[model samples]
Target: MNVYLGLGTNLGDKEQNLCRAVQKIEERIGKIVSLSAFYATAPWGFQSDNSFLNAAVCVETSLPPYEVLKETQQIERRMGRNYKSVGGQYKDRVIDIDLLLFGDIVMNEADLVLPHPLMTERRFVMEPLAEIAPDLVHPVLGQTMKELNA
Candidate 1:
């Protein structure tokens, strides 16, 4: 299955954390198919002291979307994400891995949302996504990355 993962780090060797996350993914589920160049970005929400390093990884995986999201969260916690509440939103994570898209799937259940609800709106997400999948359509919007980016 074609899958995309969004990786971010704002603490403790951001680039190294990204590399290690890639290694772990390769060892666990699938080989990395493509990786967008890392981008240095301002924090998108919930301001913090550190700026974030962000990138996107496209991989083929047999794991289902929910399974992938679950595993990715575990990986994040293991990588030293800590939680503080900011109006009930988790904050201050060292590393974060979000399941941006799982093939063309879309589901809005209690635990997960596919095609990533805000992906199109975030320049950080869209810029990297367009690099790797300019022709990719937003499952919900039916718009290509180039269209969305525009």
Candidate 2:
């Protein structure tokens, strides 16, 4: 299965964190097929001091969605993520990895959401995604990146 992932870092060594994340991802998960260019953007949730360094990765993975998610969380922790604040989305330290899409699969579970609930709205995600696969369609919305960006 080919999957799209969102990567972001706002705390400490943003660029290195993202780069190391890519390496770790390719090391743990299946091979990385495509990777979007690095993008600098403002923090999305709670106002923060550091702007986020963001990018997207497309990888070929045979792992199931939940297992993939679990592995990603583990990677985040290995990179120094602290999941202390159990609540609505907020910024955190080190690397933040989100499983955006799992080969067009639509899932709305307590722990995961496929095609990323806010992927379309955020230019940070959309821009990088468009950079790599502008023709990629939203499985549920039936809209391509070009269509959505237009």
Winning candidate number (lDDT): 2
User: Per-residue lDDT tens digits of candidate 2, residues 68-102?
Assistant: 88889889999999683357668656888988878
Q: Model 1: per-residue lDDT, tens digit, 10-29?
A: 88898999898888777666
Clashing pairs in 2: none
Per-candidate total of colliding backbone pairs? 0, 0
Find the 10 residues in a row with the least total lDDT in model 2. 84-93
lDDT of 1 at 137: 86
User: Least lDDT summed over 10 consecutive residues: which range in candidate 1?
Assistant: 82-91
